[model samples]
Target: MSKRTIDYYTKIGILTPERSESNYRFYGEDSIETLHLVSQCKEQNMPLAEIKEKISLYYTSSVEKEKLLKYAQVLSKRMEHLEAELKEIKPLLDALNEEEQKSIINRMSPQSMALAQSLIILFN
Candidate 1:
């Protein structure tokens, strides 16, 4: 972690550490546990304010299944949007020559191209 992040957490009171004789901050087990929780939340693209609120409310080292499921919904929504976008691109794809179409397909990731192909098949 960067010093800025630690300082931000400390400034926000999300993390509290004790000052030692040399004035170096020392964090206890609770702080360590909170750091782990914060890390997990950050990895899931959670905002710091929401994470702070969740930490304050739950005060746990583990994320609950409900919270995990809620996060997964973001991915579901994103996939739906991608499917719609791919659908719109379908008509434009028909205007391109075979080589141009292949070039466009090559530019896309395999998974994305597969999704486009599946949409084409489904609609046709």
Candidate 2:
């Protein structure tokens, strides 16, 4: 990793560096692993504040891997839930009888129709 990235993490208190007699910042093996983790979290687009908390937890206990895994699983479940809900909407729309569908279309004003179309585009 670049020196700038390491410096940033240190500045933000996510990683602490040891100081030599000359006052040069130095990192141990654990700090190296922490930097690797910070990189991984950034790749997944986690917020810096949240990454700091995760790393803090990693340092505090023996269940570091489990904590990270739980975060990943929660995110995975949310995506799955949203996908299922979106999929269900399609079948519900399809199941509406022709008359029901036409009635909804007929009742919708031009502005409402446009809004509905926009909403569909946004979600899809």
Candidate 3:
């Protein structure tokens, strides 16, 4: 709803709202949906070039349903891998008392924390 939101989408080439006679930008359903998809992909930390390629593939494919199904399959596999890692880690996490958890946090690097967050999100 804000100019910054529109500007971000425009910068990504995900949305191109048309200007009205009064120079107000008007976003249609397609643009809004594209923006939503772009935001979701970004939240997952998917690379922009990969996102662009996927978007183009979605639009240009004659067998869109098949392509979408394939993409879903890939995502499913990723989710499965994440789930397995979480399963392996959950017991260890649960076994740690509060003090241990604090100690682990104190010793963990930022990169390790980020990786853990990414793994959790992927599974989630």
Candidate 4:
């Protein structure tokens, strides 16, 4: 989408982007997804006001949706951090034998294992 269009959307409170200290706006996955939704609604000949209302309804109609969005954002950040850490340790991990790998896995807490599995499922 064009920067002008995004600025317009932000002005109308439809596509909120994070603002930096320098006043630069940074759009994330949610904004991209919102853009896709707006495009689809427009393709269906929906008016912009109606599209805005629909988007608001989709977001506000359910508490679960709000919570899920928050969780997803948190998980996305965690995944990014974990990816960096994994990149640093990847060579070390590759050097380990199968038994060593299994031992490391066995030493991890169940919650960590579950979180890793959930992240795998979420991204895939």
Best by lDDT: 2
Question: How are the candidates ranked when ordered by lDDT, highest leading?
Answer: 2, 1, 4, 3
User: Backbone clashes per model, in order?
Assistant: 0, 0, 0, 0
State the TM-score for model 4.
Answer: 0.47
Put down candidate 3 lDDT per residue, 1-124, tens digits, no spaces: 5789678767777667789999988888877777677777787777776566567665674757776787777677766776797779878987999999889877878876787778777666
The local distance difference test score of model 3 is 0.75
lDDT of 1 by residue, 33-121 (tens): 99999998886577787677767656646777776676567557755776787678778988999999889878988776687677667
Q: Evaluate all candidate structures by whole-model CA lDDT and list the values in order.
A: 0.79, 0.80, 0.75, 0.77
lDDT of 2 by residue, 41-124 (tens): 887677898788778777885667777787778677745665666567777878999998888789978876775665566668
For candidate 2, the 10 contiguous residues with the lowest summed lDDT are 78-87
Q: Please provide, for model 4 over 1-124, each residue's C-alpha lDDT reduced to its tens digit, 9 standing for 90 to 100.
A: 8889888999998898988999988999888989999998786566777677667766775656665576567547757877666667768977999999899889988887796667556544
Whole-model lDDT, candidate 1? 0.79
Q: Candidate 2's C-alpha lDDT?
A: 0.80
Model 2 spans with C-alpha error above 4 angstroms: 62-124
TM-score of candidate 3 on Cα atoms, chains taken together: 0.46
Answer with 1 or 3, whichever has the higher lDDT.
1
Candidate 4 runs further than 4 Å off: 61-124
lDDT agreement of model 4 with the native: 0.77
